[model samples]
Target: MDLTVKIKRYNPEKDDAPHWESYEVPADPLDSALALLLHVKWHIDGTLSLRKSCAHGICGSDAMQINGENKLACSVLVKDLVDDSGETVTFAPLPSAPVIKDLVIDQSRFFEKYRSVKPWLINDTPEPERERPQSPEEHEIIEDATKCIMCGACTHACPSTWADPDYLGPAAMLKAYRYTFDTRDDGTEERLDIVDSPDGLWKCYTIFNCNQACPKEIDITRWLSALKRRAVTSSASTAA
Candidate 1:
């Protein structure tokens, strides 16, 4: 089927503001939106700009607003986008961030939030001769959170983050959850302090938009709720 892809385009050197540019391309029904994008760039316009790597959805680099929702372009099929009365598949850069060019948004702020949460393990204990041991049950607790690829979809979909850029956002909160729940991590209290502020866990309104946007299908809202519960319990215990 031939699909019309309407992409929002912006070039800082030329255009004062972003504008829409449409392209018609022949595509397999099973072809992904990323494939369609490549076709447009390869066949139609070489100047078209977008970011993609590992086109298999593992790298999370091709994230964009597809047909109104934030998704990894490589994971959305063209057939899935067409309706009973075929509509054009629209593409745009992720919301709530500065657009660098066509379908590419600045991610520096997102990474800064992730860094604030300290996404790595902090174990002060002496290194084991072999490796830090963990039971199957312990690993299971954080396995889902560990699946996060830092795609920024959840963060971009978050209304709170859109309203207040300082809000830690779902991606950072999930990272916090991952490390806080880890059996070997010794930074739970410090991490908790980082997320317990106004711009952190408390800012989440439980809208669940993050869960919908996540291509990894991680229940970001659930993890954020769990983090809230842990924060409350920790505060109560400390007071006592």
Candidate 2:
């Protein structure tokens, strides 16, 4: 089937502002949006730019705004994007971040936020001869949180982060929750303090955009709610 793919294009060196460019490509209905993009890049326009490593969606590098929603281009089928009459599919760079080129946004801010929460296992306890052991129950608690691929979908979908770039956003807060709930991690107190600030978990406003935008199907709102509760309880205990 012939489909029109509209992409928002921007070249910092050439264009003063962004503009829209449309391409008509012969694409299979079963083909992914990324596939259509590849067709355009290979056949139509070699100058078109985007980012993708593992096209299977594990790398989360192809995240972009598709039909006004943040999602992985490799995972979204072209059929799903078309209506009954098969209208055109639109693609744009992730919002709230600097766009480097067509369909690509700078991820430096996203990674900085992720790093702020220290998304790693931190245990000051003395190490035994063998690796630390965790019960099945403990592992299950953080299993869903650990599924996060650090894709900027949730973060870009967040209005708070868009309004205030300093806000920690859902992805970082989710990472904070992941470690805070881990049985082996001993950095809960420190993590809580980091997220208790104005630009942290409290800024979420419970909009639920992060939850809706998560491609991994992870319930990010639930994790943020849990983090909020933990922060409140910790605050109350500290005051008392």
| Top candidate, metric lDDT | 1
Clashes of 1: 0
Over the stretch 16-53, how does candidate 1's per-residue lDDT look in tens digits?
A: 99999999989888999999899999999998899999
What does the lDDT read for residue 211 in candidate 1?
96
lDDT by residue (tens digit), candidate 2, 60-179: 889899988999999989888886436688889989889988787888888998999988988988998998899999999889999898888999999998999989999999999999
Clash pairs (backbone) in predicted model 2 = none
Predicted model with the maximum TM-score: 1
Q: Which segments of model 2 are wrong by more than 4 Å?
A: none
Query: Candidate 2: global Cα-lDDT?
Result: 0.90
- Model 1 TM-score, 2 decimals: 0.98
Q: Output candidate 1 Cα RMSD.
A: 1.0
